[model samples]
Structure formats: structure tokens, C-alpha cells
Target: MSTLFGLLRKKMLAPSLASVGFAERGFPVTPSAATVKLEAVPQAVVCGFEWAIEGASLWELERRLELVEPEQRGFAYEGATMGYTILDAMPGGGRNRTRELLEGPGKPHIFLTYIGIGFAMARLPRPLWKNILPELSGVPYHPTMSWLAVDGYGFDRAYFDTRRWVDEQLEPEPYPWAGHPGYFSRAFDQGVGRALWFIHGGDPRAVAEAAGRFPERRRPDLWSGIGLAATFAGGCDRAGLAELRQASGPHHDELALGVVFAVKARTFSSFVPRHTMTAAGILAGLTVEAARALADRTEVAPDFDAPEPPYEVWRDRIRADFSAGDQRRAG
Candidate 1:
């Protein structure tokens, strides 16, 4: 039921499964069970993109998305959100598609859905960025968490153009996303940190090294991103997670903060895989329940009106708790 334009959009925008492989991206990840699993995550995203761009109805998309296993289902929804976001930005495309998805079945996966909006931003013009976020006023973390879209944008850029964003360490010019231009670059670096996980194929040492390569100030955000991806997307085992923790050095609290957020997201979606639980224990030194409690305890109100967005405040509270060694008792 796709229009000709929708078909063409799918053809042009949806990435091939093979393209997401580490080898395709010139990464040095060895062919292993872990690498294969990591690759499948993006492939799932691509599937969602194809389905959404092909004009799948909400019911149809939900059916297709539900077919994905629980652990990876949120990621597929991320891709579908991205596809719908892109469509919504196009000429003659109404903006309600993203709103409908997020307000309905996409609500559970709202965290990832915001990141999907970032993926769409990578493809759209700057002028179109304003219309990207829908009015989800009563949504739990709508405006504040929208920073994940910027994070997602950073992830997309680093993933697709490693030489420029990663190797060259080019800083993106700041834009006033969510009215805080100062924090934009930090959120972007968080996404770059997430990319480092994929770029290094979840090698704990390599990810640590990649993060260290950035300037000292940027390392905290980068480490935070790495923690989120490593825990949520999960390419490494417990020992590897321990190694990542060890390698984090002074940013260990920042890394643990990311783990807490990842746990919150997974728990919010009502699907915490064993790997996430393992990562929480190894990296954050807390059980999943404890991590979720820490996140909830530190969460800022949605209407937190200040120079800093509530998202950063929430992150800061968690980070501060980690620094004080208080997160372990959060549960």
C-alpha cells in the first residue's frame, strides 16, 4: 500500500544488513558470536526503517515490531520511529505520524523512539529540525529526554563517518536543541560514546581507548555513552564489562551513571535481558532493581524549568550518587 514516493524512500534510505557489519565499516572486530549479535541490532533497525518507509500502518508496524524478540524490539521501534520521523519531515507529509506512534504503542519504547528522531535528523535539513519533536506534553520524559535525539544524531554521524567524527575528533557546532545550546555538544558526545561501542565491536579496551583519545572534558560524556550502549545493546560478556569498568578509571562514576540510565530504559520497556542485568552488576555494581531505583530517585520532574534541562539534572543526580557510593543502597 505504499505510494511510489514511499517505495522510493525505502529504497534510498533503508540500509542493508551487510552494511552494518563491522567489516563493512572498516572496524577491526573479529568474526565472533558477540560480533554477530551486535550486528543484528542494527539490522533490526534497518528492518524497521524499511517497514515504516514502505507505509506500514500503525497496526501493521506494531505487528511486525512485535515479531522482534523483546530485547531487540525497542531497537526496531527506534528504526520505525526514525522512518516515520523522516516521512513527517517530507513535503506533504503530516507531522502526526511520530506523535501517534509515540502516544500509542511506541509509548513504552519512548526512550529509543527519541533516539530514532535523532536518526531522522541526520538525513533532514536543519530547517526541518524544529518540527521534529511532537507535542507530548503529558508524556513522562518528552521534552527533556528529547536530548537523546541529539545523542542519536551524534551516534549516526560517528557510526557512518568514523574518520571525521571519531578519528579526526571533529566537534559539531552547537545548536540550541531544547533551548540549551551549551549542553548540545555534551549530548552529542554521549552519542559518540555509544558509537565507540559499535565502532570497536564491544571490545572493552578498544572502547576505553577510543574514549580516552578525545579531550579530557569530553571523556566523561563519551564514557557515559559507552556505558549506555554496552549495557543496553550488549556486545560483550561480564568479564568484558568488568574490563570496561576498570578501563574507565576516573570516569567510573560517569560510566555507572550511564548503566543506571540504560537499566531505567530497559525496565521502562518492561524487558530487561540477562545481559543487561549482568552489565548492571558488573559495571554499575548494582542489581537491576537497585539501578532502576537509583534512576527513579534521581529523576527530575518533566516540567523542570531551568537553564539546564531536566535530563542533565537527572543524569547529574545519578552521577553524584554514584560518586558518593550511595547508588548501591538505592534499592
Candidate 2:
């Protein structure tokens, strides 16, 4: 049962179902059978957020989250973790709820959980950003994958304020997240790229055109985001995936990098959906097994002392491998 305060928090902070609808955001998503499934993704996140803010116990939360379908269960965990991050940041609410979720049943879903923390970051004041990520010593990908939070932040901004971030192509001021201030905008653009997949209702042509609207410099990161979303979220068919790849053109390697990451995340969760496999084969030119092997071989150790974050290093390694293969083919 929720306390009065918890209920109040839910009422104040949780977004309504209608708020995430395509029409509500004025996105040009044409009505179709695919649209309903695509929209449900965000609504699942909203449900998870409400449950967590309502002070549900971990066991109760796990039960509720498990009820979500396998494909979207991770996203619900994303919302719940976001809610917990918000509660932890509030005055007199330092229950370490985010830590509990991430370190416990939320472990497998750590990738999405970090993104959820970013969603909370979107709602919280800048000062509280520091408190959003909790220390998870010995956890496999704690700080390194934490950059996904920024990606999540970018997704939130673009999804909510499309005119400024997406339409106007406005760039966010840099912050020293993960101690790489310069890379912040790039990570954020990747999130915006993910949003384009949804904003365009998984239409390959629309997503490509939207990315084209941005300056040439930002398209690579945006294409990377699109690749991640296309593989992981899977809104389109095999032909559509090929179309997206063709549209990527010069940024094809970056798109493949995103596909590799998405496959790695899914493999980590121990559930590689058929669509994800199909996407990997088409977008990255790798089978699910091959993608997982590539991600494993290219994995970088978490080293904050290094010039670049291990996350980017890991990404670069993947991109380089793809480029090498392409060069060999050209020869």
C-alpha cells in the first residue's frame, strides 16, 4: 500500500499515459498497427515509474515488472529505476532505492537502468545529477556504461521538447558527466538518434531525413542511436532494416556499432528476441552469436584514468573492427 506522501509523489511526478502518445507530442507518426506497439514502450516506462514512486517494495515491484512482456520488461525496469533515482534525490528520501534496484533483480537490466537514471536526471535539478548514480563496486559495467544515462537524458529532452532539440537542432550545454565534458554532446545526440526511431514511427525514410536535417557533423552519432534503437526496439521489418542501413551511407560503420551494442545488451539480459537477431543480421552483417562474440572481444576494461572513457573506447574498437572488415572487402 502506498503512503499518502508516496501517492502524492506519483500524482506530481509520474507522466500520464496520454502524455507519451504520438499525437500528444505532435510527432508525424502515421497511424498504423506498428504504431500501437511502438507507443506501448514509453507507456510501460511510465507504469514502472508510477509503481516505484508509490513506494512499492522491491518484491512487489519485481512482481509487477515481471508481468510486463519479455521484450519490454527491461524498459519498465528503466522507468522504475528512474523513479527510485528521483526518490533518492529528494530531501528526506535517501533510501538508496536506486542502488537496491540496480544491484538486485535490476542487475541484468543494468543498461536500461542507467538510462532510467538519466530520465530522472531530466526531471531533477542540475545539482542533484551527482546523486543519481550510485556506487556499485564489482558490478560488471557500472561507471563505464553509466554514459547511457546521458543518452537517456537526450532521449527525454528530444521526446518531450521536440521543437527545440529535434526540430531546431539545438545543442545542449556541456556538463562534465563521467569526467568527459567534451563527449557529453555526442552521447546526448545518440539519444536523440534513438528518439528519431520512435518519433518517425519506425519509418526508415523519415528517420533518415530527420537525421539529414542535422549538421553533417552530428549525423554519425545520430545514426548510431538510430541503429541501436532499430535493433533493440525493432519497429520495422527486415526490408526496413536494410533501407535504414542503405540510408546510413557514410555512417554505416557507426550504425553497425550501435547494432553491436544493442546485441550485447540483449545477450547480457539472456534474452535475444527474434527481431533483435534479424536486425543484427541485416544492420550489422553479423549473426546474434557473431555480434555477441564481437562485443566480447572488443570489450574495454573500465579505466577512468584513461584519456577517453572505456565506453567510447569499446565503441571505437567495434567501429574499427567493422572498418577493417570493410577495407578488406574493398581490396
Candidate 3:
């Protein structure tokens, strides 16, 4: 976003985005993953970083990013998938393609579509977000929702790419992956709930059912993702919010606490989106003073460093809090 107009647009939007709780700050360039390094990272992510640093406009960057075929099927693919989705809508529009992906045999890459919506989110504003998200009302908790992690990446990169928000970046480490047997890269799925929040327009009941559809072992993680998204983008009513928590069964508090911490941490960012304020309201249970207090508490946490591996840390923290009893209760 370093182009003259992109810079000007960012400058104009940064303060407003910050006010809404969206982080306009860019991520660092350091490779902090336990297993990877700069050169070893996914080519598109690294190349995207280089492209941004070199002042590629969104249009110019999309040339490579939007292409469906990848340079190489590196360890991580969502980053590149997100790049494609940002340039334009999905094939035959959002709803049709999403439905086909969901109802058809290929369930895995379905998350790719959701994350691709994040790219759309980067280019389009919240008012128009519905354009890319399509209405998947009765879609039953499709597993692609698990790819909500990709959606999170899309949101993170769309709103906070170092190239776009050049003022507050640091060195980044490698993007985290679940290693070896891969197992669908839950490491990458950290923000699945948040993206689900966006995909379902913050419908707590829908989010709950979606999480429930996952398996006994996966519910807590799914709920936590929902909590993150609810805090970041959900605008549920109190009753709906309560239902959201209720739907999570026993892990509701843990989910809310994680999302609260996430929202609180991001509040320190130099930029935010307009919906952030609404999300802050949801995080605070719809009270501004409470939200402020919530923010104040997280502002001083010991491990809250912008340059660290945020998504991974949050996941670890939530899982650490999750107990067998809690899991049973949730079940």
C-alpha cells in the first residue's frame, strides 16, 4: 500500500480503523516459528512481503496472488489463496462456489474460500463484505469453517500487512504450521472462529452449531476461534451472545476470555477498523466503560508483545486453560 494513493488512503483510514479496533499496524519481518526460517517460508508469503516492501500496489501484487495455480505447493498455501480471492470474487460468485465446495467432495479447500474472503475484506469495506461472504444460512457446520484460520490470515493480512501499514512493523518469523502429518494445520486454523464470525455475520447460534459439527476433540478450539471472531467482528444481541456462550457448553468462559485478551491486545495497535468498536462492545458485553476497563487490563499483560507469535500463543494459552472436566462439560 505504499503507492501515493494507497499511502494516502491508509493515512486517512488508519485512525478510523484504530478507533474500530482493527489493527492497521504491519507485522514484523522476523521468522519466529519454532521450525522455519526466512528462506524456508512459503514463497508467496515471502514474495508478497518483498512485493509490498518494493511498493507493489494491490493491483500489481494480485497478478501473482490471484492466480489459482501456485508457483509451488509449499507447506502453507492459504496465504497465496487469500491473494487470489482479494483481486476478485470467486468463480461464479461467492455463494455458488462456496456451496459447491461445501456440498461436493472437496471439503478441505473450502476454508481456502473463506480465507479468500479475507482478501476481499482487505479490498472491500465492511458494508460490502456481504458481497464476498454470500449467504450460507442453512449450510450446516461445513468443515470448511475449520479453515476459518485462513479467514483469519486474510483478515490479518488484509488489514495489517506490513506493506499497507508501514509505520508499525517489525521483523517477522515463519508462519506456524502443524508439522509432519500436517493434520490440516490447526496451527493455521487458529483464527477459524473469527473468520467464521465474519462468514456467518456473527450469528452465535450458527457459529455454535458449526463448532458442534466438528468432533468431540475439536469443539473447544473451534469455540475459541468463534470467540476471537465474535470479539473482532460479531455484533450479536445479549440473548444471542449468551446463546453463543451457552452453545460452547462448558468452554464458554475460556473462549470469551481468550477473545477478550485478543481484543485487548489488538487495541494497542496504531490502527483499527470501524467494526472493531462494535466488536469491542460484544467483547465487553455491550458496555463501553467495561470495554475500556477490559482494554486497560490487557494493556499491561506480561506476554503481550506485538512481535511475538500472537496466534500460536493465544492457542496455547486457551488449550492450557482447557481441562478434561471442561471438555466433558463442553461436550
Candidate 4:
């Protein structure tokens, strides 16, 4: 009965997309992953999700992020909401102001700051965001990327303070995970990848360079987040796509697999009104119909929108697609 219900949901999901104008106009995936001029991407690909942020920019929202009492800073989505709001205002004219804040006191909230900046990047005209990459090029990946563990603090802190979210780990993992140290860096890099997609202006080459800076073992999860942004937000060019494929190294499938997981997490949210068929279309290299079909084939029922167990399943599934020592190949 559970399987049948999930199958039905997945089936309905596709048609539901078509009903609300998430229709794929069959724009061919970029041939070489070169920068796809924003004008070239079919307007059909202009996800309506970004339209919401088009309103008046909330002033100093990022400033407020710093001000939020530590307890208040820990809510599940509020910090992100704050991040998006500040970026929406294009505070200090978007990246210019964020560039300063990236180094300023808001530095601690770098995870939320960059994530919100990514949200801003999704809305802005391209190349504007892409140029900022050079400013970040000199930075190291680990500590910079690991700051994302701060993004997990709300959940981990909640668990620790109230015993509320997940079973507390016996001791902290090296990186934060539901109050565990395990996978902390992975969590951090995932945020970095999501933000990197936007920072590179969806250029694959930039993404590759950014991902390249990370230690090799760390690249897969980072690529996974990049894939998520590239898919959910629809920016990477042919070269970017190819770079992602190549850079996935051993974790290529796992990286692409993140798109599937992110699609599920994001589509269920009110944040993406088109239900992400467009994102699915981008990642699967499919027309709307084909993308929908693929999702239906892989869809499963999970009580939580972003369940953890299947994340591992998708990760391992990608790994299994490769034999021992098989590396991801770029076209």
C-alpha cells in the first residue's frame, strides 16, 4: 500500500507540473557547458520561484542576521529567510555589499550569508554574480567550507539543549551532523557548493576550479550541492556541466544523485511553486515529459521532506554505479 501510494504521488507530480506552467519547452541542454548567455536560456526556464524576491529588498536583513539573538539565530529556516531577504534588497547593491560583509562581522554567519547570496544570485542577471568568484579564489576550501557546520548549529543546538531533534550522539563528530561530528565537513561543503553554483554564475569552469580547491575526498558532496544548485536554479553551461561530470571524480554519480534528492526536498516546499519539473528537466537532460518519467521511476515515500537515510542510499547508489577505482569522466 505504501509503495502504491508513493507511485501514485510521483505519477501525479508530473502532470501537476504541466498544469501550472512548469512545462519544459525542450530547450536542448547546452552542448559544451560553455556560459549560456542568460538570453539564450529559454524563458520557459525562468523559474517563477525567483519572482517572489523581486519585491522591495528588505534593508539590513543581513545585518539583522548578525543581531538575531543566538537562540533566535537557530531556527530551521528563519536564518535562511533572513539571508534571502537581505540579498533580495540587493543590499549595498548585491555582491558589493556582500563582499564586504563576507569579511566583516557577518563573517561568522558565512553559511547563511553565502546561502542567501546564492539566492540573490539566482535572481540577478548573470555575469554580475560570476565576477565575484575571483575575490574568493584566494581563500582555502576547508575552514571556509567547514563554516557551514554553523548552518547546522540550530538543529544540533536544539538537540543538545532540549533533546528535541535527533538522538544525541555520544560525542561530537568531527563535523556537525544532527549533533554528531560525522559528516560535518560534507554538510559544510554542500552549502558551499550550492552557493558556489551561484557565485560562479553557473559557469562550469568556475565551479570546477572552486571544487578543485577542496581535498579530493571532499569533492563529491561539494559537487552534489553544486549539482543541486545547477539543477534547482538552472544556471550551469555545457562546460560547467562537463566540469561537474569530470570533477565528480569517483563520486560523479553521487554528485548527480544529489540533484534527485534536492529535487525532492525543494519541490515539496512552497518556495518553488513550479514543483521543480524545470529543475528536473535541467539535470536529467530530459524534456519535461522524460524528466517527469524519470522522477516517477525513482520516487519513494518519505515522511520528512529531506530524510537522511535515503541521502546515504543515493550516495551509495551513485558509488555502486562505478566499479572500484572507476573515476567520473568528463565529456
TM-score of each: 0.97, 0.98, 0.39, 0.41
lDDT top scorer: 2
lDDT, candidate 2, at 127: 85
- Backbone clashes for every candidate come to 0, 0, 28, 16
Candidates in order have lDDT scores of: 0.91, 0.92, 0.42, 0.41
- Candidate 4, 1-331: lDDT as tens digits: 1245334433432122233221232222233333333222212111211221222123433433334334223121223433333343443535443344444433443433444343333334444433422143223221233223332332223212322221231222353323334555455456555545544556666667766766677667667777766665555545455556666565665565556644543432323323245545444444444433444454333322443433343345444543332434431
Stronger candidate by lDDT (3 vs 4): 3
Whichever of 2 and 4 has more lDDT, that candidate is: 2
Ranking of models by lDDT: 2, 1, 3, 4
Candidate 2 residue lDDT tens string, 1-331: 7999999999999989999999898999988877888898899999999999999988899999999998999999999999999888988988588898999989999989999999998999898886678999657887889999999999999999999999999998998998899999999999999999999999999999999999999999999999999998988998899999999999999999999999988988888889899999999999999998999998887874578888999899999999999999999
Worst 10 residues of 4 by lDDT: 43-52
* Model 1 segments more than 4 A misplaced: 326-331
TM-score, cand. 4: 0.41
RMSD of each: 2.2, 1.0, 19.0, 19.1
- Residues 172-250 of candidate 1: C-alpha lDDT, one tens digit per residue: 8888898888998999999999999998999999899889889999999999999999999999987898899999999
Q: Pick the candidate with the highest TM-score.
A: 2
